[model samples]
Target: MEGVVSVNPNHVCKLHTTRSWDFLNLTLKDVGSPQESDVIIGLLDTGIWPEHPSFNDTGLGPPPSKWKGACTGQNFTCNNKIIGARYYNSDNSSDISDIQSPRDSIGHGTHTASTSGGVEVAGASYFGLAEGIARGGVPKSRIAVYKVCWAFGCSYADILKAFDDAIADGVDIISVSLGSPWPSDYFDDPIAIGSFHAMKNGILTSNSAGNSGPNPVTVSNFAPWSLTVAASSIDRKFVARMELGDGQILAGTVINAFDLNGTSYPLIWGGDGANYTIGSSPDIARYCLNGAMSTDKVAGKIVFCEAGLDGSGVLAANGVGTIMSDALIVNPDYSFSWPLPATLISPEDGKTVLDYIRSTESPTATIFFSNAWKDVMAPKVVSFSSRGPSAISPDILKPDITAPGVDILAGWSPLAPSTVYQDDTRSTLYNIISGTSMSCPHASGAAAFVKAAHPNWSPAAIKSALMTTAHVLDPSKHEDLEFSYGSGQINPLAARDPGLVFDASETDYINFLCKQGYNTSTLRLVTGDNSTCNNIKPGRGWDLNYPSFSLYVKDGEKISAIFTRTVTNVGAANSSYTVTFDMPPLISVTVEPPVLVFSYVGESNTFTVNVTGPVISQWPITSGSIKWMDGTHVVRTPLVVYNYLPGAPYNLDSEQAYTMTRESLGLTHSNVYHKTGMGQSRAHPQFL
Candidate 1:
């Protein structure tokens, strides 16, 4: 009863995977060290592919004495690089895939494990793409895999079991790339509960900010104690170019391998090739749905398909090439490579291509793979990377940071297929994938990098180092909004020496849980200890001493809130930092004790921020930041303020004043208010 309460089954979320090293400046020769070999990163996912070259050990030593976990199953064994292995599956359901062993039948675990601490694999490439020495953020660090997730999805009971074992096994960090679609209470959510225990055990947990994105309040893994990671791109990008009959050229993004070699083919729209008599209507054919386009009409022709169409299916229908458009907007910067020679253009460009095809009798176009381009405007948050205004606890920022998650090349499981389709049997040692799942391990490796550097630092201190030293800029050199990119893109090299860190201990988090209204019985279930909220005051969730500040305001209401945070001086002794505020319009911010002087390392100073602002309906979310400038170092904390109005349907507790205070900044249903005000609301000034 004290440990893993009950198991709930959930559906599986898809994959995303990694020059990542050069992108993050985490080359093995520069950052790798034996110190990291002692640092263990516990991976909770499908399982590990031990035979993969990435986990070959090579120069690694024996397992650390601190490790308490054991290798499970008959054939499953651990190497020097992969120190421990465990599996958990309480449900005897027949739907489970690969349940008899700890070995990964799915590719996700192998990919994530490699990204976190896989050994350096030279000449690593995915089908001749991203060719170079591929390595994790900290190549020398040891990895321990906990197979909690099978093919169906991760079970809540199994996840909790993995966490209990991982914590007891003395893992330095936990990297989980799974999450639910909606936010759940910390008491009920397995991730939230498991991560809480990991935090208590002095281990940092890095999690994925789910792939459901460009949508507000879709972020998962929002617990303040865990480090939620978002996905972004690096300088190198994959692209494809299209040349139309009118000499018009359009460019899009994708990992296209096939080269047309300047050859042109007859281009036909799917709708024009539809056989209406077979119920393949023009509209349905435009989408390129199954059985919508006739093989006779599509054979050897470059077919233009709509968004959501199965490119592989089109290729199966004898289509030589495919040009697809985005469903939402025309984003020239975003694209994906399909099984066939294909390119994805924006919706606007799709219209132009359609117009040209209708006008010309013999429409012809050439599609070719373009060489990798170094984006001057790099590090923009990918559209698919989940956005936040943390739905669970708006006071705390969900994604602690962003990393290079787009089109990363890493080790792949030979047992798994490269394509999404089951019949595609193509396998490779290295593969390219993308998502926050990829980003999570990037952050985890960075955390391990910091842990190796400062072995004495707590998880909170490690998290603070990363957050305070992050860079807050988009690819275009514009200041990125806080909610979109969290603190900003992670700077692994810079994080190791962050001058000051906002640190919190296990007791601090227990206090936070108490404030969240968990009673003694619930607290015991979460922490597996005799705990009570009796002596703890029901405080504000924002006062949890987080690295960032999140203040909520309801529409048409005036509110004033105070946030208290403490920073530990990790730089040189006798350092004096003067506080400076970047306040957004419609909000006024003032800090108490603007100057902090520390005469010794590890010295700490607490500061209070009093923020007053009116809820402007026009701007649903606005942001600002505070910097502690010590001349040589800048310790920054991003400040986010959103408009959250509490009312019907949600049935949020109004009895609890702090909940009301916290609920005032609700992010979940903020769109309802945005829709109601529409044209009447005046535009507010942008803050970044």
Candidate 2:
């Protein structure tokens, strides 16, 4: 009992699973150094494909002297680059098809592991698409794979055990691309519990924000101890072009690898093949649900179907391809990849396709292979990346930052199919996928990048560097503001040399836990020490020395809160930083000291931010920033004030929140995710 930490009933968590380093202007030449090779990144996911070129240790030195991990599973080999390998299935519920070894059978683990600290593989891609040199943000960093997920979903028992092992294994950082379906108490969540220990051990844990998004209060992995990452676009976008016989061209956001060899195929509306005799409705056929379409009619035709539908019927009926018309989340729908040649177009374009199909006696169409298009309006938080005002801790922001997560081409396991569909026998060594899972590893790599440059920095210090030096995002592009992308998209180059950091220690976090309402007994279970709440009232997160400031206010109540923060100078000695702020006209914010002058590096400075505003009735949330600028560096901290109205139409209480699904969230891209609970093609669950 004395040795045991907190215990919880087993709960299942699902797996979640990048791109453009050039978009961040991070070239290989300026990226890694000998110090980077000393850092080790531990990944808790499905597993890894060590045989892949991404794990090659060619010309690399042996593991560091502090390395204390080993290869603990069969059928897996670890090199200097991947110094550790272990697997867990404490639930004993893996499918018979699943291999118990650390070798990845689901591509999610391999993809994420490579995205975090993979060696550069030249000319890597998925079927020649997204072709480029595949490398991680910290390519020289070592990777330690801890297989915690499986076909039956990741059990909390295994997840916790993994954390126990990884933290003791001398890992510098932990990357987890998995989460539970819903928010739970900090003590009840395995990630929150695991990461608390990781933080105490001077290891930063990077986790996914989840795929449930375009919806408020859906962020997962929201604990303050972990770095929750959101998915965002890079400069590249994939589009599948459709050419109609009438000389009209329609482009849809998708990843279609199959080529028709420039030949056109007959096109037909999915509704035309409805099995009316079997009580199948036109809507059912139009959506292309299985058993609704007649095979004879749709075979060899490119079926036109409504978007957000499984469209599995088309494949089942031997249809060559599909054209999906998506009406929701327009301005180019979420990009997805299916086994067959397919494309997802806007509803308006779909109307044109339907018209051509109905008017032409013998309609014809062609879907070209997906091509990469440059998107100028990128770095936008993706629609699937979870939104925040954390369901667990609303006052403290979740999704600490954003990273390149969409359409990331990374290492893959040949044991798994290229597509999520099991029917497709295609296999590849590199695949493109999207999720906060991908983004978490990117953040992990960035954290390692910073750790390499500042080896003495703590986990909180590394997180502060990443958050303060991030690239600012446009509020106009995101509806939820900071809730959508956290501080901003990551800037690995700038993060390495952040002028200052807001570092917190184990004692500070214990105090924060007390403020969050953890009693003495519960605190001891978590901290493994006799820590007391000391009569601290449960309240907003104003005391934690976080890099960002966020206040949650009631809808009608006056917005008045004071935040006291401390910054540690890690830049040039004898430098001074003058404070500047940009806030809305309705809000008044002031800092006690106008400037901070540090006579030497590692010197600490304290400041207090006082904000007062009239009741904000028209706006749900308003944001500003506090910048401490010197001639050489600018340290930025985002400020967010949200009027969170209880029992609002969209807000859900803990008792009522469990029932809310992506379906309830209204037309979230249901087909895109690749959960451990694998779906039958375009029907994956939201957790992964």
Candidate 3:
């Protein structure tokens, strides 16, 4: 207890993709992976299905010499491709569906493990949908599985233990696909603490951004030492169609693999078959709320449940088919196959179908099989990928980059059900799933690729390569800019040879934590060395050697701040770099000594970007980027200025209040003060 800084609940974190390599152009034939045979990617999830073809060792050599891990799971074997396998359940937790060893029963671990470094598997498909050669970013990279999650979700203690084992086990990159309900302090978060240790040992940890998105401030992995990945899309999508009697076709969402062969079924509204004690009531039966429909009335009829997931209800009533409606799902590009002849239509479509049914005495419709199509809006961040302006570190950007997460086809366990619907009894080797969980492994594999090419690079350097060399996303699609997509979607090949990398060492992170308010002695509890916060500069966040820059200003405050950043050149020798800015609206940004000349590789250059602008009144946020171009390679990172609240004061009365300390922010800063209520400042909390 003496060394304990804080106590956190052993909160059970939830488990949160596919193609997608070809979408990024990291194809099996095109990708020139350099010596990736030795790179080991450690996965922390449920567990792996060792017998899956994706884990086949075929041409792979033995484990890397640096791999000090072991296969400790009972009855679980690790091949040359998967160098190690182990499982952790500190609470000895068990579910009826859980397996007792590292063997995956839930399939999440297998899905993620193979997604990160699975061997190339030909004829890989999800029930003949989105069919293609399933492959990871670096197919040749070795995998080490650490199963920390179970049926009840991942325990923080187990997660911490897995992190400890992963670090000690000599993993080159750690891929964690689970996270807490919310991000805690770095010292308190198991992933953060473990990743910090991993970073110290030259291992980069890539974590999911959490699947609570389309909503802001939901990111759960925000530690600067690790990479927090957001979820995006690839170039593909899926849909199902329903045809009315008049031949009017309505495209809906559902992976209906079942083919009715153009057979029309009589349509009956749920209300017509209401099992109400008071007799037929369309209003009550409309939702088809479990057992609401009468079996005799709905039997052999295509039931139209106005707005509900009454697939089971319809089935119990002996309905041949069902049409459901959801008002919320608008233009969603993903769907899953249901066991029955089913399709989910939009609320507007539901109304039109209801009208068609009313107008015709005998309404009939046919549901067709699911089909695949190209989505022009591919690579847009999915609605479920968590958003951020991190609560842990406001100045630093979270979800460092976006990767393909929606509808990812990867290795799955035969022990688990393929789709979310339990009634569907179909099983498969690979399953299509979506979440930030899928995106994390893509980034991890990419990081492995970069690390394999540049073995001498630090964890931070590899991260910088991925971030700076990423493809800049369309600002029109990502209105939140860096907060939503970070440095944009990852580009692994470009990352292998990033011209410049914003590298940060242990001391740099210590300073970042110091700026986040950790005092010297408390910080010692973490670093366990003679680390001090004395060198911490007076800033909310920009002082750290982060890839991007973010500043917070209050309403009508004259914007002024200075950000100093350092970059280590990893490009060609005798390279000259000059900075260019996509300046934010109505804000002036100037970089001093803009030209950075690197005499040789690994040479470091530091630059200070100063800003002095007129009183700005943008209530929410505006973002831009600066590119350091050397004519051959361009290194880019986002620059943002925002004011979350127009005239709001520092909220100190909340249920979970964020109270800043003077020793951390007040005593060290130029414009420091203790605010009892709402106050205004040039550089305040950046929340929107």
How many clashes show up per model?
6, 1, 6
Worst 10 residues of 3 by lDDT: 679-688
User: Per-residue lDDT of 1-688 in model 2, one digit per residue for the tens?
Assistant: 6667676778898776535777777788877688999999999988899889999999889999988988977777888988998998877777754888888887888888888898899999788798879998888999998988887789898888899899988999999999987777777788888899899899999999987776777788988878999999888889999999888999988888889987899999988989787898788788887788888888999989875444467888899999987555356434667778988887889999999998999999999999998878898988778788786577687779999888788898887767645556678999887778888999998999988988889999999999999999999999888999999999999998899999999888888888877788777767766678887877667989989988887757788999999999999989999999999888899997989999999999999999999876545778999999998888988999887634332323343454444445452344333211123233222225
Give one digit per residue, the lDDT tens place, for model 1 in 1-688. Answer: 4354544454333232348768777665677677888899999987888888999888888988988888887687788988889887766543433646678877788888898888888898866777887788888899999988765567777888899899999999999898864566676678888999898889999988876565566677888889989888888888889999889998777667778888899999988878676877788888776677888888888888875343654776688888877454355344344667787787788998999999999999989875688876778887667777776576787678898777778877787655433344667777676777888999999999999999889999999999989987652432336666899989888899999999998788888888877777777766767777888866568689899988766667675789888888999998999999887677899999999999999899999999986646634566779999988888889888776634311212222532344345453334332321111111100000
Question: Which candidate ranks first by TM-score, i.e. highest?
Answer: 2
Distance from true position, residue 429, model 1, in Å?
Answer: 2.1
In order, what is each prediction's RMSD in angstroms? 6.2, 2.9, 7.4
Model 2 quality (TM-score): 0.94
In model 1, residue pairs whose N, Cα or C atoms come closer than 3 Å (at least 3 residues apart or on different chains), thus clashing, are 16-434, 17-433, 17-434, 18-408, 18-409, 377-475
RMSD of 2: 2.9
Query: What lDDT would candidate 1 get against the real structure?
Result: 0.76
Tens digit of lDDT per residue, candidate 3, span 214-318? 556667788888998998888877777999988889988666666789999999888888987746477778877667889888888888886535266787888
lDDT of each: 0.76, 0.82, 0.78
Model 2: worst 10 consecutive residues (lDDT sum):
674-683
